[model samples]
Target: MNRRLSFSLILAAALSACARQPQLDDPVARGQRDFQGLGCIKCHQIGGEGHAWGPDLTLVGFRKQPAWLDLWLKNPHAWNAKTIMPNFNLRDDTRADLVAYLSAQKGQAWTVYPWRTAQAKALPSVERGKLIFNMAGCVACHGQDGFGGYPNNNVVGGLIPSLTNVSDGYGRADLHAKIQYGQISSPADPSKPKPLIYMPKWGDQLKPDEIDAVGDYLFSLKPKPAPGSAAASDDF
Candidate 1:
């Protein structure tokens, strides 16, 4: 009887493993459907229509990894305590398909995070960026270290992320865009751009090198030790 039970369990385990793997018809489209059917489009616009309650996903594929997105879609609250995005426990098959779809629309990953060579040496600066943070009056709202301060005057949006740990949300390219534009993916309606409290279009104000310098600096600011978390600071 024990042997029969063990055999049954082994078969079940084998079947589960097989189920996890896709037959591989580019599961991305299936995932895209899941993205839509699951009602993500209601707030976060994807191929247009849904518009932009969230960042434009037009080029999201260029930004995140499949495995990362898959995990995120499954559970966002687990990662960031403040994200307004909802977690959709999408089936594994649909999730794989979504990753594939996004990948298809993705921009050049290396351009944003060139991991090799001479140009690659141009990593953003955390030290110099601190000075820029205060000088630019980013401290008025985002607070020192760019951690995003308390919303004193109806200014702080409840769902906004705390910069105390921002490096995790965006890629190097995403950082570049924020520092250059002060907004995420140019707003659909320029007349009503309020990504974060009346962010003035600084694209024209900052110069080529300063933009690079400031952006690199902003991207470089690593969070000190988060409030009371006893874990040793993450090295990277």
Candidate 2:
């Protein structure tokens, strides 16, 4: 009886393994698998899945040249001297498959975060800020912690600012302006031109109070020193 049960378990495991196997004939499927394996999902979004630290690659094929992409993927620093993108050290075959997968991505709307509607009010918790950051789709560029230095795939020569220590200088009003209007850049400087406005205007998307909640959340990201730490002293 024990032997029969063991055989049944073995058969189930074998079937499961077969079911998990990807289709080898499909280049798209192979490419998707390779993309995930290379940890591209850590900072990129394809078809509304994965992280949003980089540009939405859903329409990458439409925006970027395949040749440019091949070179960019191999070494991002070659194109942008200050780009934070890292080389994956991928082999030729893997890079080819990954590029094929990225090139197949076409115009698709970003996935609406599940908790967007639920986050209408500002809750006084850093944890809530973290949730709104992701649910509001802020994590795609600013990251889950509000630190935003990730290389953008769509905007080749744009600047992405970090929000981790924003509260150190900017007051709540400044935060309100920046968050609701995407006003990080100075309008006085024509050379800057308000920084290409990569971030969407939260004023249109969220209510004033809701925007305030997000602002509060962003302002709270300053690291608190441990008890008895010298940095914790109020005096300089």
The lDDT leader among the candidates is 2
Error of 2 at 66 (Å): 16
What CA RMSD would candidate 2 show?
A: 9.8
So what's the TM-score on candidate 1? Answer: 0.38
Q: What is the lDDT, from 0 to 100, of the residue 132 in candidate 2?
A: 54
The global Cα lDDT (0 to 1) of model 1 is 0.55
lDDT of 1 by residue, 166-206 (tens): 56777766766766666443333456633323343445444
Off by over 4 Å in 2: 1-113, 116-125, 152-159, 184-197, 231-236
- Per residue, candidate 2 scores C-alpha lDDT tens digits across 1-236 of 69999999999999999888977676667888987887788887765689977655665654344676788878878756766779877788777877887777654343543334445333454555565566555765576587776454344344456787888878988888877886333343454424322555566555666666777788788888897788876674
Cα error, residue 36 of model 1, in Å, equals 1.9
Backbone clash total, candidate 2? 2
| Candidate 1 deviant stretches above 4 angstroms | 1-24, 107-236
What lDDT does candidate 1 reach at residue 70?
A: 62
